[model samples]
Target: MFYMSSGNDIPIDPDGSSSPIPDIDLSSILGNTLLIGIAIVVIAAPVVGFMAWEPVEEGNVKVVKKWGAASGTVFEPGAHFINPVSQSTVSLSTRPQAYTMSSQQGDGNRENTDDAITVLTEDGLRVDIDITIRYRVDSAEAVNFYKNYRGTDAAEQRLIRPSIRSVLRTEAGRLPVTEIYTGEGQTKLKAAAQETLQQDFNEDGLILETVQIRNVNLPQEYAQSVEQKEITKQRKQQKENELEVEKLEADRKRIEAEGQAEANRILSESLDQNVLTEKYIEKLNETDTVYIPVGGEGYPQFVRNIEGGSGQNSGQNTAQSTNSGSTNQSAA
Candidate 1:
């Protein structure tokens, strides 16, 4: 037996009469839209199969996990073909990231407000600190990191956050609030936190880049006290500076007085009796009168000019006798 096709005959049975079954058109029964939809899906199946190929972004590494666990397969940045069903990628960023503990809203990885680190100093004053730690996942050991911590978020939440607070608090408790507030001591605190956190991050396949102690906020009472103390210290320094200036002035005055006394002593030593007499004689030459009232010998004798050429010094009157031919000196 055989069946008749549109253009040929097809055999069905060997010793029976041929029966032709009616072939209903699938497009007529299911409609053209459904048929077109089936054809599109059939054609697009191979293209959609490319979902196995995952593209990684820059500064990131993708860890392909099998089942629910890490498969030790890591993919670097760019397109990679991965199994769609059993295998998937967990992207881990190798770029620098920061975990900041701050008081300001939305300033850190956290969403809640006022998440700054609060701890006590050696002096027992409560301190709230704002700090930021920079680090990156070591891509080489990313598999091992995921094996232990499962993911980057879990690693950060479990290890890095707690380690930062622990190391910072431990270091801070060693110093008093005054030292921890600023200056070289504050620098030391940052260094200590960085060192310890570095080790902790290294153990978890994370590279610690930097640790920044942005702000150290002390209690209000302590801040006010410190301000008052600073004010007093400034006043004390001002007073000391004034005293130093006064001491320097006194030293200068003393030096001037000593110089003046030395000058007077030298002048007195230079002037002997002969020097005094010479100075007094020299002084008499500049005057209008030719004779002095007092003589050098302390006697009251007046002497006119020896050279009579100066008319002012020489007197017009000469000694005269009243009687003629009498050789006598007259006295007035």
Candidate 2:
């Protein structure tokens, strides 16, 4: 066996054999190790810093913090420097985003689950309302939003959804189920809900663009009932319209009858004895035979008769006589 001494020198064999060990300088080893370490750090620092760089995308902002304390600096869309050892950046989008709550799978902001909002009306009915809300973080208030909510998901989960639900519940509770299902009432509800959400979002550093109630899910039984009620209401309205038309028709007939009666009254009032006598004479000329009544004992006695070729002349004479008699009677 060969053993080497601590003092760099020769190796001594146990069987009296000897060999020389290579001379190595400790200072050179230490210096070389230090140089390599410095080179590695110089090369790695930029790479690490580059890797730590946070990008604030378009329509977004990044909140930078140092040592877990907000640095009070918000970075706009661009590459920003951050200390890898003591700083971090949280990116928040400022673009308008839509969040939908729906029972169906494909229609909402979240596609993985059913997030429909359920509320109770004044009539104690459960209504599932699918709504889409468009909103965004106010760019000016991004820091405040970051400090308070940290991220969009947190804000949506804690603030937006809850506020929407609260407002909807309160507003919906004020309306009966029937009213909620009606067109005018539903429009009012949507407007009210949007107004309430707008106020809430304004206070929370968010801009609410729109609130749309996409669908309403009523209980099966209630839906059927509503349908039946709607049908009945339409039928009643139709009947009322028919009655109104009938009333108008009756009024028109009454007006026409009144006008005809007035016309007849005027005609009758214009008919004096002279006019009646003229009309009687005109009728007499149309007849070739003349019958004159001579007695008034409930029996008519024919006094004179005229016919044939001299009928027209006789009729004309009779008319003149009749006219003279009517005039005398009037004078009397």
Candidate 3:
């Protein structure tokens, strides 16, 4: 009743050999171990590759795609996982970018170049203008903008500049020449230009910052004429001012003269004729003697013969006596 340790004494083995009940191969175990290690490496390569990638930076977003087709969902900045074989991401900046373009000088050989734009005034005068536009990209919409308008170098060259230029020219064309130069007018024009640009560019995914007019170049002849006209106007105004001053002075002098004449007239009217006669007699008597003119004399004869009373009416008496002597001379 003894049992064999291997299949040696088993009924199933045709020849009794000193072997265990089940055969185990050390080479097969090692081969299986090697296959498992190879399988682990094959699976880990893609996992490691996926783990190593990072998404777009902060303040930016990644445009995710599957097999080159957009997923329509944006991925924010961080470490992220994507389909290793089919999905990908493209990052775009979400920051604002300012653009500045200055006008190029025309042929420098000419002394007087027509570096002017002809703008029409409301009064139909043609004026020259110089201006600048300052603008920036909108960060919130730059991601979409990069994908669409700035898709490639060709798009930027062919589309963006032309659009901006067209919009600017259209706005400038609508403004009058005078409005572009004056202070309040320039302010209004700038506001209108900014609004027009914002409306036009915003639809095309652009943001506008500001538009400024740097200079307005009127023709030299026109400027000189305006100055001369201003000078003439000032001179005329000065002459009118002088005339007004003279008129006021004349009126003042006339008023003073009239006032003095009225006072003199009132005094003359208030006096009695008898009082004037008495004043005349008193002045005559103040001469202290009298001269009588005789017809046969070479000169008037002097006489001091007022030998009447030295009474209170002496002045009146002298006048009367002179009159009586004149009557006697006439009678003789």
Candidate 4:
């Protein structure tokens, strides 16, 4: 028989001996329900605790927000606690990142070239220049940065490239083409770009590390013209040098010829005309053939014969006088 607290006796089995089975153990059932409830709470508490908030690591910052919306405060690397229900975090790197842009050559064709800034020279020439930039996010200001410019590192790349390009273009436009190609123009351009970029990024709480100029390209036709002009200038200089050397050599030869003529004239004057005539007569006597330029109607030919005959006689007379003096001395 099944019996309730107000039991009347409804027979559950015909062979009922009615042993009074301990009524339904109410304490045990209640204890089991309580244990199950505790287990559920234990498992759920940790999951909720972790989701509510997390910590930022070393050399990093967590940009926290109330779900989709940003919070003004940036959290530096270290332990932090947040509401498990309301906030989420985005991590940003504090280390510097490098961006390299390729350069082009003399031809207008760009090879491995990226977006570049065009600059004008003092002479109103246009030149394209490539740039490289290295930078990072300052962790202390990271939270403000996120609020101002939200997103990931990809967002940083987007923001920085455009900013650099803008600054470069502005600076390049202010410079003259001649200065960019030569002189201190390149240095000034780099400094100007750097200063502008740093100022803008700093205002936005971005850290600027380095800036570089990769390539500067001009028109092919202009390049060729410059080369030709340089070559012509060099050739003209070489010709001028050669002319100077030739002038010096000609002057030296003229001076030498004039000196020799002066010496001959002086010697002729020292000896007198008679001495020159006597020397000519002596030379004619010593040679088998005597020739002289005929001038004034046969006078030169007549003088030549007379000089030759007189020179021979005087030589014979002088030899005889010398021989006679020697013989007299020996007798004495």
Candidate 5:
């Protein structure tokens, strides 16, 4: 028997008849190899691309570092092509974050603890303060923030929390315990603390949004003392108000009396002798009887008609005689 080699046209036999074996086609094998290679590449291309691409979500930025050094480029929210073997990306959230320290539970981003801050006031009294700070990595300076703290989460632990504690301690120390317990003074302290912390955060490439003093715990004895003082003060104010009301009443009464006296004085000054005589005559004309004072100033000497009897005849005679006497007196 004869057998043909697949690589060449030579025929060889080990046993049996001489029948030619078909030569194997090298082109087909090569074509099949090329197709397999192409298929492998097609499958592996996506895998390589998937490994090299980095996706940055919204509200976040990715900092790419190449060869252990920053590439000085930040990728915004989109698909970014990067060399996975030689370069890597660090994704950081540019959104606002909160760091809260309080005795009560807070939102998910808070550090709830019973360990309130104890600070000595300027007057040497102790005060416990619970505070919350809202902050964020400056989006424009996210790379710098990353360089300083190496990460956004790290910025909170290393930069924000410690700075807040330090600023709070310093600002609280400047105020008296009495003032610290008051609303106005607490507001001032919060402002001062916020300013200080903002400055500190700015230095570390972070933005300080707000600083809130959640609660302030005062000594029991001091709180009671303040309560008593407030009670006494309110009582004193009440008494003062009552006295003011009384004073106003007295002033009103005095003014009314003075007005009445002035009215009486003016009336008295206006009534003269002639005015009185005219008033008396006007009253005499309204009745059938007349009375005359005998010997007083501004009074007639006698009364002629004294009764309601039929004095018409006598009255006419007397009136005629009186008319003649009045005419003679006028002529004289």
Candidate 6:
């Protein structure tokens, strides 16, 4: 039999002198275990929470890939529980970006000294083309883009770079290299390149904003030849301008001569025989001899000075005079 001892802290059993189990605080032990479990739960809650949810930032989307999930799985910008045990998230940016290929290092997206594209023109000239591409992932087609390239970086290297190179080469082969050297031709080339590359971009779920030809470098001899050709063209234009001025001067001289000849013809047509006889009588006292018109010609008539005998040579002058050419005088 178990019996109570003198104090409540100890008890006696029939087979043993004392029993320590009877003196143990059972209520306290139970209470301590419950508190310890509560503490463990409180400590582990935050850690589990962190592992369960992902935060997506602005301008970014998360692609959650799970075993049973379709390839089109996506998550927008926000905190979302993705079940850390089974699903994974890849953050992708949708902002526009640019890729510059250039011949000089540090001037382009590439680190190489000469990352410019080397292409052959239809005219069989080699040129280095520096181009830039502005692009972005199509948000609606992000899944397809990711599936095709796995990431934006891969898309730039494999699709963007290669497509630009291929399209530029194709366009360069369609025309002479001299055409590409002109502003309008460069514009045309850029348009064709952008158009062709845009098709490639669209098929691959990428958006091509712009394609720019930053620079084009021809071989040294070709560059010199182009410069000389431009000089020749300028010279030809100058010569044409000079010839135009000369033509205008010749027209002015021709007009002046025509006006003078027209005035002389009008004067000759206005004069008559009556006006000629009056003019000859008005000048009779000023001359020793006069020309009188008989038919279409003139005959000289001498004027004798009776008061002074001043006109001494009038007779000699009349003897020598014959049919002169002055028809403006009448009988005087």
> What is the TM-score of each predicted model, taking all chains together?
0.60, 0.57, 0.44, 0.55, 0.68, 0.63
Give the runs in model 4 whose Cα sits over 4 Å from its true position: 1-26, 49-55, 78-81, 104-113, 152-159, 226-332
Order of quality (lDDT) = 2, 1, 6, 5, 4, 3
* 112-142: candidate 4 lDDT, tens digit per residue: 4545666665567778786777788887778
Query: Could you tell me how far off, in angstroms, the CA of residue 186 lies in candidate 5 after the best superposition?
Result: 3.0
Question: Candidate 1, 162: how far from true, in Å?
Answer: 1.9
Which numbered prediction scores highest in TM-score against the true structure? 5
Provide the global lDDT of candidate 5 against the true structure: 0.76
Q: Which candidate would rank higher by TM-score, 2 or 6?
A: 6
Residue pairs clashing, model 3: 6-19
Superposed by TM-score, candidate 3 places the C-alpha of residue 75 at a distance from the truth, in angstroms, of: 3.1
Q: Residues 68-146, candidate 6, lDDT per residue (tens digit)?
A: 4534778787779877777777777888889889999888887867899998999889999888888887877777777
Task: Quickly count the clashes in candidate 5.
Answer: 2
Give the Å shift of residue 219 in candidate 5.
Answer: 0.9
Q: Each prediction's Cα lDDT score?
A: 0.77, 0.79, 0.59, 0.69, 0.76, 0.77
RMSD of each candidate relative to the true structure:
10.7, 11.4, 14.7, 11.6, 8.3, 10.7
Candidate 3, lDDT over the whole model = 0.59
Leading candidate by lDDT: 2
For residue 51, what is the lDDT in candidate 4?
78
Off by over 4 Å in 5: 1-11, 18-26, 41-55, 67-70, 105-112, 260-332
Worst 10 residues of 6 by lDDT: 299-308
TM-score quality measure for candidate 5: 0.68
TM-score of 4: 0.55
Which digits, one per residue and each the tens of the lDDT, describe model 2 over residues 1-332? 66666976666779878866779999999999999999999999889979787877799988788898778888999878777889987778899988888999887767877888899999899998888888999888788888788877888888778888888888889988877767776687689878887887777778889888887789999899888988999999999999999999999999999999999999999987567655655776565554445334322222122222335555565566566556655655
The residue-by-residue lDDT of candidate 5 on 1-332, one tens digit each, is: 45555885556557644456789999999999999999999999999899898999998898889987767789989888999789998888878877777655543255454656678888989888877788777767777877788886787778766776777788888888878878887797789878887788878778888888888888889888988999999999999999999999999999999999999999999987667767876775575445556333322333232322335654564566456556655755
- Quote the lDDT for 215 in model 6: 86
Better of 1 and 4 by lDDT: 1
lDDT for position 225 in model 2: 85
Please report how far candidate 1 places residue 315 from its true position, in Å.
16
Predicted candidate 3 versus true structure: per-residue lDDT over 155-273, tens digit per residue = 33454445444544555566665455668766765676577667766765556666765556656887787679789999999999999999999999999999999999999997775
List, in order, the clash count of every candidate structure: 0, 0, 1, 5, 2, 0
